[model samples]
Target chain A: MPAIQVTNLHKNFQTKRKAVGLRGSLRSLVRAEYGTVEAVRGLSFAMDPGELLGFIGPNGAGKSTTIKILTGILFPSSGQATVLGFVPWKQRRQLAYQIGTVFGQRPQLWYHLPAIDTFSLFGKIFELDDRETSKRIAFLAEAFDIADLLETPVRKLSLGQRMRCEVAASLLHKPRLLLLDEPSIGLDVVAKQRIRDAIREMASLEGVGVLLTSHDAGDLEALCKRVIIINHGQIVYQDKVSALKRTFLTSKLVEVRYARQVAPDFHIAGTETLKVAKERYGVKLRFEARQTPVEAVMARLSEVGSVVDITISDPPLEEVIAAIYEQAERSEAAIAK
Target chain B: MNEYHPTRTPAWILLIMRELKFLLAVWKTNIASAMEYRAAFIAQMLGMILNNAVYFIFWVIFFDRFRDVRGWELSDMFLVFGVAASAFGLAAFLFGNAFYLSEIIARGRLDYYLSLPRPILLHTVASRSISSGLGDFTYGILSYLASGYCTWDGFGRFLCGVVLACMAFTSFMIIVHSLTFWLGNAAGFAGLALNAMVTFALYPVTLFEGFSKLILFTIVPAALMGALPAEFVRAFSWGALGKLFLGALLLLGLAVLVFHRGLRRYESGSAIQVEV
Candidate 1:
């Protein structure tokens, strides 16, 4: 059975429309207006056990709303969602015991207390016995290289150190499923690498199903094999990371450095030559793949001049995601028309 | 085959023990953190003591001008003030987060408690500990001792009063906290209402005759939290005690019902993470 099953889940919020100033406030007191916002609309997805899925979206793309519903933090207005064979919102207690959550922006550790104290608190919260709690804490602390910083207060620790502690705190119970929301936010390159490694190790070694959501493409690239894209309260696409790259990215930029400068009008059918720059002894050409493959582009470049160095790279994930959103917008408009 | 039955342990006892364990763990951390800022801790404690003393002085002067009002002596009024202040302080110290429910809800901090494997009220109250409430506790103990109200029977009555007072306070706090589910940011409104109750409650309810007394006793129930408990101390009446107990039970039931009902309409705030 799938570890998580969500079917047409929906959530809407009614917010009061209050005006400014004393007059408006008094006016509101007499008769206040309310506006309804549809946060999640008929969202449906399912994940198998031990699957590592990346839930990616823009700021208000309903990624967090979906996660909240899945984790039993918020109830859906309509439809059904079950995690581990139990209804999430109805069986929150049971779900909480089996799942762990790490919110990167919010360290679960009590700010005033040392990281170890927070770990111990979670231990008690989950009712883990002393022996098992200590063993797990020790193991995670060492793996995250936060053993030395265990005694340091959370407030005193740096963002990277606090993040490590937060991850350790979340795993003290050895939850069967882990939900990490922006676990690499506000961390340096080294810290991000460490977090990615830890997440990879946890999923592979412990067999814990992982759902990660982040704006950081590096985090998605490093830790997730499967990517799910959400836009405007809907999942537009979900597939293997490699497949997403290959399907969305049609053109790969191939920069070639020549031995001598040449004013070559590099005319290739089904391809646009974007730019040309002359170096002291070399020429560089930037092109977009209209119909030709990257290999063909490289071959054409080779024919044009002596290629000293060559590199081919696709557009950044940010651009690809933006293009996807634009494509979605255009399609919606077409359907409306 | 013999029928199997489950043993029935009192729910309050179980709740108390769970809360005690949770509080002890939280308190240890808070105290350690408090020690780090020794000067700030002392300053805050001193400020609270001074605040309470100012109020005590006002009562003293009022009683000096008019030795008795509504046939209640100045000393008796002092006793009421002492008990009410201490009880309020203790509740504030232990469950102060109840006062910040609106902010927590607005910021989505309540998501943590909602997601936890425990009652939302218990989790929210236990999330933090307030050290300033110690001042109220101190004054209460001192006033009970110095005012000659600490007789053997008075002690027993005071014990009962303390328990009932805590229950009443908890009910009030829960009711206020639950309002956040409906009135998104009702902290200021709730505070105003609670302050009004406390103000009237710390006085002798008998002073107000007829409908006013009924209003205090029933609608607001401030009189029961204060004057009624004080009356029990003066003399035990089964009828009066039963009335107070019944009132508490009813209010508690109502509060819990309202909270759960409002929870149905609770729209959690943005998923933006919050730090405690």
Candidate 2:
């Protein structure tokens, strides 16, 4: 059975209108006005056991709202959701024991106390036996390589160290599923890499399903087996991470500077000249990696001039997602037309 | 998805015990955290004691000049402060977050408690500590002693009053704080209401009568938190003790009901990622 199943979920919020001045405030005290906002519009998705799925979206795209509903923190306006075959909102307390959550921006640790203290307290909260709690903490500390930092107060730990502790603490209960919202946010590259590795290992070793939300493309490419992108409260794209790259990651960006002036008519087959700076004697090219090999492209560039410098890189995940969003908009406009 | 299957829910007794155990563990962490800064901890406790002492001195002078107010002696005032302060102190020290519920709800800090497995309301209240409350509790003990009502029976009554008073005060604040879930940001208003409760509770019950007295014993319940407890300590009466106990229970039940109802409208704030 799938670890999580959400069907046509909808969430609407009513926010009060802010009064402008003293008169308006006094008037509002008598009778206030409100406006309804649709945070999640008919969203539907499911996740299988041991699957690493990336739930990505831009700001205000309902990513957090959807997670909140699935975690039983917020009720859906209309629809059905079950985590581990139990209705999330109805069986919140029961479901909480089976699922672990790590909000990168929110630390669950007691700031003035060591991470071990919070871990011990969590044992009581989850009703774990002392022996089991200690064993699990030790295992998690070793798994996340945080044993040395366990005694350090949360306020004294570095951001990366703290994040490691946060994720480790969440896993102390041996939950069957993990819901991570921006778990690698605000961490350095090395820290990000370590977290991704730990999560990947946990999913593989324990068969724990993970639903990770992140804006970092590297996180998706490195950890997630599947990717789901949302925009304006609806799913824009959903598929294997590899399949997404094979389909949308069509072009490779190349920037080059020449030793001398280049011709205005500079062009190559299966390649597009994005820009030609005459004053700087430089040119930028974009081409399908399949159509034009990197070696062949560089060989061609060298023929044109004594290449002073060259750089090649695949299009970033943001740009790829943006292109997908553009395609979606165009299709939507066409349907409207 | 599979059909709804009924798993054996734990017995209510066991669940309550687990919740209590979790609360005690949280309190341990809070106390340890508070003690991390030894000097600051000492200062906050001592500072509250000194502050409460000033109020006692003011009452001493007032009673010295006028002798008594409406058949109420200075000893009665001490009893009032003793009961109120001890109750306030015990509630604040143990369930400190109750006093800050409005701010927590307004700022969306409930996310932490909501995500945990424990009972959300109790967990949120027990997870914090008010260091200065220790001083208030000490002052309460001293005041009760100074009233010269230090007999064994009197001490037992004082302890009972403390429990009832704390329950009334905590539940009252919870009711006021729950307003933030519906009113968006009611922190300032909640603080004002709490200040008003404390201000009126410190005065003699003889000063109020008719509708004012009824309102105090019912809606605002300053009498329930203070006058009733003080009256029980001063002159033990079964009727008054029953009312104080019953009032505390009713207010607590009402507060819990109101808070859960308001949770339906809670719109989480976005600025709750930082440490509390």
Candidate 3:
């Protein structure tokens, strides 16, 4: 059986409609209005065991809603979902033993308590044997490099340190399936890289099936083998992460710092000046990687002024997903017309 | 990777034991959190005790003038207030989350408990501890002594009354909070209902008559939290104790049923909340 199987899943929410100002508020108190909001409409997908799937979507695109359903946190309005052969909502307790979840916005650890306190509590919660719990804690502490942090109160640790411990706590049971929602959110570049590395290592070591949702494109590129792009509660794209990047990673964003200020009109062909700071002697440029060679673009940029430093990288994942959303919107509009 | 092993034990006793174990774990965490702010915790507890003492003073003054209101003397009033406060305090101290269920449900804070592998209502109710309730618990013992119930049997009976009162108060709060599933943002209404229940519990049942008395014994069950338990403690009667036990069980059943039914329609909140 697949690790996760969701078919024709739908979730509808009835939200109160509020009017503006005091009159409307008083009016609503006497006679309130409610509207149905379809959060996830017919979301269907299946994940094989040991698969690293990147679930990507813009905010309010039903990413978290789908995760909640899969984790048995919220019941679907209609249709069916099974995780590890157990129906999520109906057999939630049975399914919980095999799965681990880390929600970035929600801290599972007790704020005032040490991470070790929570680990011990979770040990009782999962009903692990004393020896087994101790062994797993020791192993995870080393694996996540949180040996020192285990003693620190969760409120006292830095975001990165706490996140590392959070991931470790979820893995104490050696779960077969792992679900992480925006695990690298608010982390610096170095912290994000460390987290990505730790997650990839853990997944490979335990052969755990991972379904990760992240807005950071680097997280997808570094870890996921397959990517699912969702918008408006529908799947717009699903394919190999490498393939998605290859098709859409057509542009490169380049930043150049000059020793002296360059002319306002000092521009290069096949390139767009995204930002120019005359005082700082810095210019940000964007160009199609396929259309303009990096060597040609560099040659032209050097002509403007003596280059102090230069950096080049692909455009962020949000831009790529935005383009995909735009393409999907256009197609949807065409179908509507 | 380990195969998925189901933890669904068929034995009802074992299930209750496991749930209890989880409850203890959550309570430990809550108490530990409260202790982290030692000065504030002490202050809250002391403040609550003083507040309850002030209310008892008014009862003492009233009894001094009128002697007794429909056979309820100063001693009975002390026991009534003691049982009500202690029962409420015990429930609040251990299952503090019960008092805030409506707010939690309205704010979609159930996400955390639902995601875990435990009984959702039990976990939610025991997630936090009310520090101020320590005062109520202390006052309960002191009031029982002050009411001149100094015998071993009286002490034993007071303990029973406190247990019944706690169960009744906790279950009643659960029923009121469960309304959020059907009526969104029912926090304001739940608070008012809770206040009414507390107010009725603090007074003598003799003060109420006819439909008001019926409502108290049935829907609101303020007597279950205060008068009936106090009456049973003061004068032992199997009939009154049986009624209180049966009533508590019914309220518990109603709470569990209402909460589970409401869980079906729970739409999680969109607002970003971080406890840390």
List, residue by residue over B1-276, the lDDT tens digit for candidate 2: 889978876799786776778888989988998898999989999999999999789999999999988988889988889988888888889999999998888877888888888778888888789999988988898898888767788889999999999999999999999988877777888899898788889988888889999989887888877889988997789998999999999999999999999887777755735543
Q: Tell me the TM-score of each prediction against the true structure.
A: 0.91, 0.93, 0.92
lDDT, candidates in the order shown: 0.76, 0.88, 0.88
CAPRI docking class of candidate 1 = acceptable
Residue pairs in collision within model 3: none
Query: How far out, in Å, is residue B176 in model 1?
Result: 2.5
**Least well predicted 10-residue stretch by lDDT in candidate 2 chain B:** B267-276
Best by lDDT: 3
List, in order, the clash count of every candidate structure: 0, 0, 0
| Fnat (0 to 1) per candidate | 0.44, 0.60, 0.63
Q: Compared with the true structure, what per-residue lDDT tens digits does model 1 show for residues A1-337? A: 9998889988887767888899888998899988988888888888889999898888788888888888788888899988989898888888898998887755678777688887877777777777888999999988788989999877789888888888878887888888888898889999888888987887898899999988777777888889988887887788999998888777666666777775757555545656667554343344556666667766777786787887677877878877877887788789899
**What is model 2's DockQ versus the real complex?**
0.56
Model 3 stretches with alpha carbons more than 4 Å out: A252-313, B1-10, B274-276
Model 1, global lDDT: 0.76
Highest TM-score scorer = 2
**Candidate closest to the true structure, highest DockQ:** 2
